[model samples]
Target: MNTWQQAALAAEIENQAQVPVLSLAASASVRPSRRLGRPTLIQMGSNIYEQVRCISAIVRSYHWRGVIAIYEDDAYGGNAEMLTLFSEALQRVGSEIEYHLSLPPISSLSDPRESVYQELLKLLSTQSRVFIVLQSSLPMATHLFQEARRMDFMGKDSAWIITDSISSFLDSMDTSVIPYMEGALGIKSYYSKSNRPFLEFSAQFQKNFKSENPEENNTQPGIHALRADDSIAVIARALERLASDDTNTPKMMLKNILARNFSGLSGNIIFEGGDLSNSNSLLFRIINVVRTGYKELDFWTQDLDNPFRREGRDKNSSRNTTKVLDGPVIWPGYLIKRVPKGWEMPTDAKPLKIGIPAKTSFDKFVKVDEAEAEADKRYSGFCIDIFREVLKILEQNYSLPYEFHPVIGTYDELVDFVYNKVITPISSL
Candidate 1:
């Protein structure tokens, strides 16, 4: 049942039985195919496309040029489609996915902690410090962050952003896991909790939940539960509308459901193309994980021309020009008021080897002095002076350790050496 194929089969069977199907699967892969004509299955979850757009905007606001993707490898094809959509969104924001790490689905993994540790080790060799997590289960996510903290991957120079799949269920996780996920950012579907109807339902839900399960400590309902309630409300309204029609067919029921547009427990319930429409009412909130729980930082909505700004703040606020969130964030390791650079060189990284041609027709432009000790070889010329000056300027901001080596080869051969990784790079001098 975790796979999209199985879900599709179940929907098809229900369709044959003349029953209207409303799926809670939030992934794009589970969406009904349009080529077959009218959709027999309707999704009642939030749109995955909107989630991707919100994440992309956050990355752009922070000016992150590259990021690493971590996602579940499942037979459902949901995470795979999510990854593709994220990659495309990042490109539109002048960013690219440097690498993608795939973890086995939680259902398939016997030792999730060890598996996550192995994957985290692979990321240590990479330079990208910004990571985007998509379509991860609670168990897998818990282990992943625990391993990340143990390996020092949760540092001042690291930034982690998780989509709603895991974020929506953070309340259900044990308190011990929240510490491991400190400094992580999450995009969660937004709903108004202050409304009278939601408040009443929450109180009733807590009362029934405690009575049903005495052992459970966290009795509050998560986004999934709220959406489930909204889904039921939608069905009830659709059935009532169907009662007016003489023919109460499954198709007619579906039509009535799609026509619904009203505020519910999870937000406005509106359908477009057999899925929740990405309208103004459909909004996502950004959160930063802290010691107690997580703090709401900002909201992303289709209604705003500039979605990065905080709610009720001026759209032209100067802070909005640079910072995405209004509140200060505590980075990993309890570092206060420090923003991660989102990249770092490995501790064991070697000095860059710069190759220089030993023989050149134009000595003024490029010249190399041979020495018995290869390390003692001297490179000097107009080009060498310019390269040295450029390095000096770069060293002010970065630690660029490099060494020059004289190479005995034609210009073409020297270029080939650099291309084949024989040398880190080559300069004319």
Candidate 2:
């Protein structure tokens, strides 16, 4: 970990620490002492069917059939359930999957001497051009890029695509690879879908909690500590109903999670079987790296056509559009772009160094406490899982390119890179 500071959203959330926090870490030292009685739910909001359709269309349109290097065997396996659905759609257009190689995890590939890169070398040996990177972590994904660079893989017309899972990794990625990975593209789940529903939720959230803060300059509105706030919304609503039903037991909570169909602020809340699906995810376009923060790219994903604007959010208003709500809003600490052109670094101050968070913040809905006996309450996040489906859907139905990768660099390293001109600034564009 490195020295760190909070973004506008982080500050917003810190102002309201009384609210329940979302947990997403996979470590023994980080689990909470108190156990949550609620069972974890797999998030399913994105549209995967549409994504698969989009990629199939792109493959057919290009008339190119090359090898596709997939990542692990989890929900994102090379030939998993989603691929089966995608293959059916692809078969219609005379295009088929050439190869399905699952890249090893980041932990396994940390050792250059490790055999993980060997499989990639074999896959690339077949001279595959149009590769689909499906690993969620960019560090692992970068391993393939490193192999390609080692093999001199980039050229004037080479094209690669990734899923939304690795898009966030680009935010704090190493800029040295920008020239090598510039043409790399990504499929996004939610870009600026932080519109009215999201804003509306934030407003109501603040109104309910009296300790809200004013909006800041060069920032957007959000509460901290909440993952996407979509999960919180779903849980909040479910709790509302459960309170009415007067059922607060673990089995009852699990039953509620399994039996109910929820409408969250993010979208229609759903699980594996319901009409809701991460498979229904959207697609956004990523071009260049915004410094070290999040990748600021053009929003190509399908968003609500009717976006609501904050009534008193005008620049003239003392409190234009920004407010701290239930928790911390996850703002891009390191954007792809640098500081504004007219602004200069503080005088007599050395270039700011990036630092790791003092306390690790959990952005997952998955539970991490191992001592808790409730197996249903153990693993807490499906947001990423849903994101996986969403991007998959984009590839399946929308013909948009969805790539994947691993998160390699240390959190501190990313912060330093961001402040030191490693990436670019974030943009709504």
Task: List lDDT for all candidates, in order.
Answer: 0.75, 0.41
Q: Write the per-residue lDDT of candidate 1 for residues 375-420, one digit (tens) a residue.
A: 4336778988888899899888878777777677788988787645
lDDT of 2 by residue, 93-128 (tens): 566665677655455555843454576666543334
- The C-alpha stretches of model 2 lying farther than 4 A from their native spots are 1-41, 45-50, 73-79, 109-117, 171-180, 191-228, 254-265, 268-429
lDDT score for residue 14 of model 2: 36
> How many residue pairs clash in each candidate at the backbone level?
0, 79
Q: How many backbone clashes does candidate 1 have?
A: 0
lDDT at 160, model 2? 58
Which pairs, if any, clash in model 1?
none
Candidate 1 structure, TM-score to reference: 0.84
RMSD in order of candidates: 4.3, 24.9
Q: Evaluated with TM-score, which candidate comes out highest?
A: 1
